[model samples]
Target: MSNRRDVWITGIGLVSSLGEGPEAHMQALSSGTAPVVDATGFAPYVVHPLAPISFDAQIPKKGDQRQMEPWQRIGTYAAGLALDSAGIKGNKDILGTTDMVVAAGGGERDQSVDGAILTEIESQPNPEIFLNEQLQSNLRPTLFLAQLSNLLAGNISIVHGVTGSSRTFMGEESSGTDAVRIGWSRIAAGTSEIALVGGAYNAERRDMLLLFALKRLAMHAPWAPVLAQPRGVPTGSAGAFLVLESPEHATARGAKPIAKLSGVWSERAQRNEPGAVEAVIEALINQARGDVTEGTAILSAASGAPEPTAAEVAVLARSGLPVRSITDRVGHGLEAQMPVALAIAALAVSQGSLFAPLEGEPLEKPFTETLSRAIVTGVGHWRGEGVALVERAD
Candidate 1:
């Protein structure tokens, strides 16, 4: 913590099933309507699909769109949105020095190619040889190129012109948590001035559903609020990115901060012992010096999986704060979950009001007064735990 500079959230870009931008999400939340969920398409699994968005608005060039995978496109577009929100989209001077940190996962799998391989391997006597040979002969270099986790940052640099230091973090929810954490840490420590940070997850794919289902983590037909019961995760398609800048830097540019990113802390606890996740959450909250006072809400990225979700809710019980399970509306976005929560928290703090109570979750109380502070927590389905605090800039 070098001199401890204030980290301001100057820009936020969030696209989820609820809709796009701050206004769309605020409207959906104020209405307290049941979120959009797709049950029949994935059959047994319920997923919050990405809302209809025109890629041309952000990714502009056809050449850029064609060269990327769905997740990469999603990330790139979100990154552009963040840059635009920061009021520095075309400023080559600032962009040349702006650092970026992205939380991302491996690219989406090509189901057709995967299907072909599986089908053909089923009949081959030497399946290993056939599989290896087929992979070597049929897999295009372009496939691997799309799978690069850093492509989100690369594409952002290409399309948005954020030509600065870049980093990509993997490992699902924790990765999202740490992306902002590192961004804040660097800016606060004076190691960097302005930075672009966040992630995107296109969970509307069969591969993503299959991966979650394998762990018995898919929510079926009767979709309910995340904390309504001990439920499985309903995957969501979303992309979220935020622009963080130091107080001095933002003020110099005449950029008004929406909220101040006060603190960020994350951890991974061993799940072999019961109550371990709860302990991790407590420690992380303590680290952030998170306030759980009245007029504050907990924007929990509870992923909706039983093990960690239960433990996390148990810990949050001590806070006695109004809680909102964001995934209930936006669904579970692995890499983008925590950052999106932070963005929503910033919006709530700035607007001075909490959203309507989450339906089906009786304990998720609604605060009628203006919102002042938000404590955002991320509990990974199986592993990491993180906590962050955002408050009104004023």
Candidate 2:
């Protein structure tokens, strides 16, 4: 551990319902502006819709933009922002070898095709055979390609010219945590000099809404702070990417270290057993909290699902660090949650201050001290628990 190289977060690209890029999010956080939520668009169910983004700013090729779904475009654009922030946007020398890890969900479904298949299958003599035939004939070939979880990475390669060893993870929240963990681990171990890591989510899709709704996991009431929500997750459309580099690599390139990624710890708990989530999260937090003195607060990515959120809340309360749930403003981004939380934590640490608390949450008290470190915690709605420590790059 003593020989491990320091991992620095040199650049960050974050887009959410709050806005695009770090500046917008910083402003939103500092000002304590109300979160933008659409209760009626998805009707009864509340969601944080993504603000308007001009895809041309990052993905210049109209053809490329047209071919990608919203999630891919979001990720590709965020990746470009990160490279640009790192001053390596068009620098093929660094990008060509920069490793890439993406956390993504399955591609968007073709609703029209799905509807037609369902409609015709009921009338067929053999519904099973008809369903199979419709699946093959009705779905477009490109649609299948779009559904590949790795397409987000592929699009980034095409548009941003990353051309690195690409890897994609598909589990929901765990995927995001693992992606960051691997990127940081590689940089720290000197296995890789630089890495691009993150994910994107499209919360406006009906299929995603239906998927959560069926499980009674979609919030159907007015928006509230994540911890205060009675039940369900208020999904958000977001894209977050971070440019992680070794201290030597960053200094050699003259890239300023926004913050230091000290450590990342990930775990999956057996939720069927009582107290398992709390136990796992407590252990991960203890591991991540290395030599910290003071000015440390917690940025929690607590998805508003009742049970896990409650467990996380209880554990955080015991830790006694001032806690702010990022989901209160950005909504629960599933795979993007961990990255978004890390990005915001880095931003806070670099600026030497923590953001204001939500109006309604008593647990998220005010913190006026100079912030030198931040702990980002993620307890997935269903499975997966993780904690990451970010410290000022002094």
Measured by lDDT, the strongest candidate is 2
Q: What is the lDDT of residue 208 in candidate 2?
A: 92
The estimated TM-scores of all candidates read 0.95, 0.96
C-alpha displacement of 239 in model 1, angstroms? 0.6
**Candidate 2: segments with Cα more than 4 A from true spot:** 123-133, 140-147, 291-293
Where model 1 places Cα greater than 4 Å from the true spot, the runs are 125-129, 140-147, 286-292
lDDT tens digits, residue span 278-346, model 2: 999988887777556479898999998889999998888898788888999899899999999999999
**How accurate locally, in lDDT, is each candidate?**
0.87, 0.91
lDDT of 1: 0.87
RMSD of 2: 2.0
List clashing residue pairs in candidate 1.
352-370, 352-371, 353-371
lDDT per residue as tens, model 1, 215-320: 8999988788777675899889999999999989999999999999989988889899877888889787666544457567788889889888888778777767
